[model samples]
Structure formats: structure tokens, C-alpha cells
Target: MTIATRRAQARALFDAGVAAADPVAATTRALVQSPVPATLIIAVGKAARGMAQAAMAACPNVPCLIVTNDENAAPLAGAQVMAAGHPVPDERGARAADMVIAALEGVGAGDHVLVLVSGGGSALLPAPVQGVSLADKAAMNNLLLASGADIMQMNLVRQQLSRLKGGGLLRIAAPASVTALILSDVMGDDLRAVASGPTAAPLGTKAQACNILQSFDIWEKCPRSVRDHLSGVDTATDIPRADNHLIGANPISLRAMAALVPDAHVIADPIEGDVAAAARVICDAAAPGITLWGGETTVHLRGTGRGGRNQELALRIALEARARGWTAGWVCLQGGTDGRDGPTDAAGGLVDSGTLGRIDNVAALLANNDSYAALEQAGDLLITGATGTNVADLGVLIRP
Candidate 1:
């Protein structure tokens, strides 16, 4: 196939992966099969709006509260939609958490709470514990994001600092039966890590949270209040367990992408850890047909350059492909299924063999951690605005 054809096909595959994880469809299906007679619906995450809509359709007249990032927040009838910061905690998220907590007030044994959970919920709903302030939580989040910590590790610490995470929501809604329909953005679909497991079990003890921060070498950099809280915390009581369902996730989307090309190689292992290392692994797996991967990757921010993991991964893959002398004809499209990559407007990048030739001093740019600028110059940045649903990320590479 021509390079252009390959790029197009790769885009198609990625789109298919995203489509497969459609929140409305997934939520609708789950609700139809076993609809929850909810007295209140709380949808939180990137897919909150879509999931809330479906739940409301299934259980009409139900009081609903939707908390999501600005990208996915929208007005819906019979529901209060609140937008908050993502990838970092903010005052707005803190207020939203208060609203969420208040909404759960007086939830009794006869009442049922339907919680729609998805990616970005951790940051979108910031209910910092008493000792920790919102600013402290935000500082810790910034540190964790730049520390190259994986979702699980980041969330393990976040759970300790928040009153709405790590089954804290379930705790607040005690005596009320809670049901959670989760959209898995974490690689392994560990529901507990998704949205910091607001309706699930706590990851570990506060000591474990401290260990994660120390392991990442960001323990000392953490705000003093955060340190004090985690160090002193053992006062949390047992949390109630909710009936959780896996409504959507990354693996399901990855398989959908691979199915588009029957002979395509579907890497069962998710793309994770350091971006450079992940790039090399992907390059090594490249064959003479479409190859697919799913899952989020981490980037240890070295410079002030703007770009998300997907953008950086695409550029790194291009560099790796060239270094391996396998860039004769290849196209790789990597993007977040949610269509918002990091703090940039681009979802990710669709890079081809010629992508390197279009950039100036690719090494310097990569070293500066400026994948967004590099990809933009190459006309490769994949910009798909707020997909309304997130199943982590999807990647497709077509080589001939």
C-alpha cells in the first residue's frame, strides 16, 4: 500500500478502536441488560456526559449529577453537569466534589446510587481529605504526572489524599446500595485504578502510598500537608463495596482496531512505561502489515515542551523506525481515544516515513520534549476534538 493509503488505513483502525468504546452505546447496552433502579445517578470522568445520558434514558426522572472535565461537560436535561480540571486538581473540582458528597446525603438503604465511572475521574473530582488542601493535591498531581508514574501508582497516592477516591464515595454512600459501570482506561482494566476507584476498594494502606511517592523520588517534593496526611493517616474506616461492572476498556478497543485488518498483528501487551522504551518495543514489533496496540504511556517531562504521551510516542516511534533502518515505508498513528492529548489541542500524531524529513533537528526537539511542535511542523498531529469517551489510547502502524 502507498504511504498515504497506509496512513489512512491506520487512522481508520484507530477510529474503529475509539468507536468500539463509545460511552453511549456501552452504557446503553449495560443499562438495558441489567438496568439499575437508581434513586440518584452520579457520572464522573471523561465519558460522564454520554454515560449519564444513557443512564437517564434507561432510568428516567432519576436525579443525576455529572462531573467531568471541560472537554466532555455539557448540558443535559434532568441532570446537573459540572466541568472541572483534568490531569490536575483544581478549585472547581474541589467544589464539584463537595456537590457530589452533598448529593449523596441521606442516601438510605432503599436508595440505589448508579455511579458511571471512566478515565480522568481522579482529577475531575477532587475531594481532598481534611488535612490536605486542593492546592496540595494539585501539586502532588503535577509531581506525579511529571514523575513518569503510571496510573496505578499515581492513583495509589491520590487515593490516600482524597476523600472521594479509593472507595471513599462508596463510604459516604453507606447503607445505600451502589452500582458502578466503569470504562476502563487503565491498561489491564483494573477497575480500582480507574478514577482512583471511587466506588471500589482502596489500593493499599497510607504507608504504601508513601512508598509509591518515595519510589518515584517525588516524596520530598510533595506538599508538606500531603506528607503530613499520608504519614499520619490510618483513621479511615472500612469502605462499602459496590456492584461494579466493566462497561468499556482499552483492550476491547484494541481488539476492535485489529479486527479491521484480519491478518493484522494485535499486541496483547499494552504500551506503557517510559515513552522512549515503549517506542523501541513498538518498532521491534513492526511487521509487513497492520500492527495494533492500546494503553496509555508515561513521559517524564524533561523540558517545558508541550505534548502528551501519545504525541511523544509517535515521534519517538518515528525516530526509532529511522534508526532501525525500517522507515522505507511505514505509517504509525497514535492517539488518545478521548481526542485530547495532554495540554495540547492535538490528540496525538499520524506519522509516516516522510515525517522525519519534515522536521528540523528532530533530536533537539525530541530532547526538548517538544513533540507537539515537531509533529505540527510535519503536519502529523492528530487533532480530533473531545471524542466524548475515553478508553485510554489506541495505536496502529501499517508497514509494507
Candidate 2:
């Protein structure tokens, strides 16, 4: 198959994976037989539009409010849609936050709130903590993004800094029955951290959030207001678990991908550890069939390269695949489900036995943290723009 065709097929497989882990669909189906009327639906994340559409299918005529990234706007027709930013908050995100708070305010005791929350909701719904300016939050977010901190740590800080995150939304909508349909993007599926757990119960103590910031050596860098908020915080509230369900996650998505490639060997769901180290493992264990894995990985960011963890993984995998000298058919790929890796437009990169033959100075690329540039030079970067889905990462090794 042509390179384009191969990528198209790979993406189709990825989409099937995403569909398999759609919490909104699962939650809606579960609620279908229940007598409680879902009067208001609040969907938030990159997948918010798709989730809203699915929820609408299950509960026809329910009023819906969708808060998603700017790229996902068109998919949420017929609903009150608000397009916001991702990875970083903007004025639009603040507006969406206001709207969500207002929507919750209107929910009565008899109303049921169906909350569709997934990854990226933290950025799309930015209700800054009192006294903390939006600019301060944005600056802190930038630091966290560049610091190579893991999602959990980053979100811990986020939950502490925002009004809508860490079960705050659930509290606001309390007395009203809430059924959170979570499409988990975090490893281990910590409900309190997924999309900052807008509908789930809170998990950490304020001291825990303070500790995480200190562990990362970022406490001093945080805004004074943020520090004061964390210092004076009384107690971590419990996420309202009276009614909640995590219907989607990396494991479910990875399993679906594995089923599509029936010949493939399925590995662990959230493949953790260092990126380069993980790549070596995949190369060393290559067999005759496909091997699949999923989950987020950290980059550590020692180099000045312009690539995400997925790109870095592919680059390292290419080096190993080349060293094996088993030319031609073996293929290894890694990508984020949201179709954006790090700050680049490319979803990730792919490598094959022939990858080394087309590239020069791979070591320099690795050293400079310039895997994206190197992959582009080698004609290997995978681009899908924004797929409007976020379950985490998908790694595939196909040897035939």
C-alpha cells in the first residue's frame, strides 16, 4: 500500500479504537432504560461535540450545551456550542466557563445533569480560582506544559487553581442528580483528574496539590494568589459519586485496536516508562505479527528538540529498527489520539526498517530534540490535524 493509504488505514483503526471507548455512548445507553429525565447535558473536551451528538441520539430532545476546542465546533450543531482553547486557556475559555456555571445554576432539584467530560476540558473550561487572573493561570499553564511534568501532576495543579475542576462543578450542580460520562485520557483513569473531574468527586487534599507543586519545584513559580489559595484551602471535597461512571479509557480503546489487527499481540494498556526506553523494548521484542500498546509517556525534555513524546518515541524506534538491519516490512508507529503531539501540528511519527536508509544524522536530531524536523526531512511525520478525540497515545508495531 502507498504511504498515504497506510496512514489512512492506521487512522481508521485508531478511530475504531476511540469509538470503542466512548463514555457518552455507553452512559447514554445505560441511562436509556432509567426513568430519570436528563433535562440538561453539558459536554466538555475535544470529544465533547461527538459525545454530545451520541448523547442526543440516546436522549432525544434534551437541551445540550457543548464546550469544546475551536476545531470541534461544527460537529455540535443544534446545541448551545462554545468553542474554546486547548492546552492553554484564553478569553473564549473563560466565556465558556461562565456559560457552564450559568447552566448549572439553572438546574433544579428534579433535573438530571448528564455531564460528558473528557481530556482537554481543563483548557476548554477555565474558571480561574478567585483572585487568580486568567493571565496568571495561562502563564503557569505554559510553565507546566514545558516542564515535562506528567499529566497527573499538571492536572493536580490545575484542579487546585480552577473553580470548575476537581469536582467543583459537581458541587455546584449538587442536589441535582449528575451522571458523569467520562472519556478518560489520564493513565490509571483517576476520575478526579480526568478532565479535572468536572463531574466526579475530588480526590486530593489541598495539601496534596501543594505537595505536587513543591515536588515539581514549581511552587515558587506559581502566582501569589494560587499559593495563597492552596495554603488556606481547608479540605478536599469528595467527588459526588452517588451517581457517576467512567465509561471510556485507554484500555478499552487499545483493546478495540487490537481486535482490528487480530494478528497483533496486545501489550499493556497505558505503556509507562521513558520514551526512548519504551522504544527499545518494542524493537527488541518484535515478532511476526503486530504488537499494540496505548497510554501517555513523558519526554523529560533535556534536548532543545521541537517534538512531542510520540515523535521522540518514533525517532528512537527508528534508530533501533535500523540497527537491527532487518530491512523492508517492519513498521512501528506512535501517536496521540487527539491528533496533536506536543506543540507540533503532526499527530506523531512512524518508522520502518527502511526509515534509517532515508535519514541522515539521526543522533543530532535526537540530541537537539528536533525529532519533528528530522522526521519531516525523512518524510515520516504523521499528520491528522485535530481528530477531536483524546484517549491518550497508541503505539503499534507491525512486522510481517
TM-score of each: 0.98, 0.90
- lDDT tens digits, residues 328-360, model 2? 676777888888888788889877666766778
Error of 2 at 372 (Å): 2.1
Residue 95 shift from truth in candidate 2, angstroms: 0.9
Question: What residue pairs are clashing in model 1?
Answer: none
lDDT of 2 at 66: 92
Judging by lDDT against the true structure, name the best candidate.
Answer: 1
Which portions of model 2 show Cα errors greater than 4 Å?
A: 1-12, 22-28, 31-36, 239-242, 302-305, 323-328
Q: Assess each prediction's global lDDT (C-alpha) against the native.
A: 0.90, 0.79
lDDT of 1: 0.90
Q: Which candidate should be chosen as best, given TM-score against the real structure? A: 1
List the candidate 1 regions with Cα displacement exceeding 4 Å: none
On a 0 to 100 scale, what is the lDDT of residue 230 in model 2? 86
- Error at 51, model 1, angstroms: 0.3
